[model samples]
Target: MSSASSSSVSAAAPASDWSAARIAEAAAEIVAGEQLPAIVQAGHPVLRTRAVAFDGQLDAELLDALLTIMRRTMHEAPGVGLAAPQIGLPLRLAVLEDTWAADEEIAHTRSREPLPFVAMVNPAYIPVGDGRAEFFEGCLSVRGYTAVVRRPDRVEARWSAPDGAARAAEFRGWQARIVQHETDHLGGTLYLDKAEARSLCANEEYSARWAQSTPEHAARALGF
Candidate 1:
């Protein structure tokens, strides 16, 4: 979920409960032959639970099905990344992709770039250095909001691919942010834990007031 504060939105109930209705609705569609999967929101028990590592499930039909559903769900959310806990599954799995083709403004501000879709199982990461950067972040699970968060500027991640091949890679820029965000889900860490609470706002409010602003600008304007 987005690093946005949970207090920003005044939902009917908690976000998790309210979003469950939509998730159930999505499940109903799936039962009716729709392939899209539902996305669970923040405050869900699953999101707070640390995920289990995949054992020898690579060859299992269930794993294959889950990956398929997750990919479809990621694309349907129109988000660049997703984690299993965001879907009511406390599994250490995540998927990510970014065409890095948002309008020039966003692309440059977030350091976006093209990256092929990747599915990582039981991923882990380490900071590459003392360098840090702050950016406005968003998440599909924490819908309709964004907040400024500070994180290491780069990280090296190790994980098993969907095919069961072990791999490790260093990431930087927006790509690093995406990796950090998704992996955090596996550890039951939500972005809000690192977010500047005063910077939280609805997506619409963010777009109107801070979309053109950087994290530094937001901090100055919002007093975070």
Candidate 2:
């Protein structure tokens, strides 16, 4: 979600109701019902609400399992990141990994690179420079749509790991976008709210027309 907030945003009790053991129970129910845990889609109450801060709400066992499941879910979705709210747990937790690069040229153009899996809790970020960049982005929650969203080109990010270890790192380019996208979920923000409306398109159209190393051409054509 974007930093732009509206009156529709709500708080805990709704999405944050699941955490610790509650999350496990929810997943178990999904499995028991012969369904895999699903991504909470747009318009759901869970996606419209802010995630709760992670402050010892889960025991070590629950935390580990939750992180594992989240990572697996993200990988299975084959997405670079997955936030807690996307999976019905509105806690400040998310997993991220991006190992794909079509080729060296695209990688360098977007500053894209392989990022190992990491589970961030209560994550936050601040722009590292005045630099900004724009590119098409898609969300697992939003499903088959993509849009151009401008974001800080670099950032100083801080979050606690699943192991309770604190981390502060500098991220730039595509990785910075990934961090911001996931962190926005904790605040009940979606990239849609911040995206250039004119650039919105179905995933198919995105691939059929605007799939490029950068968004400059699309931005010009879409009048965004």
- Per-candidate clashes, comma-separated: 0, 4
Give me the displacement of residue 17 in model 1, in angstroms: 21
lDDT of 2 by residue, 1-224 (tens): 21110112324324455555665565444334433478889988777777777887676777777777777777777788888888887778888888754567667887887777888988988888799988888998888898988889898889988888999999988888889888888878888888999999998898888888888899889898
Report how far off residue 11 is in candidate 1 (Å).
28
Model 2 weakest lDDT span, ten residues long: 1-10
- Residue ranges of candidate 2 with Cα displaced over 4 Å: 1-35
Query: Which candidate leads in lDDT?
Result: 2
Cα misplacement distance, residue 109 of candidate 2 (Å)? 1.2
Instruction: Give model 2's TM-score versus the native structure.
Output: 0.87
Candidate 1: misplaced stretches above 4 Å?
Answer: 1-35
- Alpha carbon lDDT at 193, candidate 1: 78
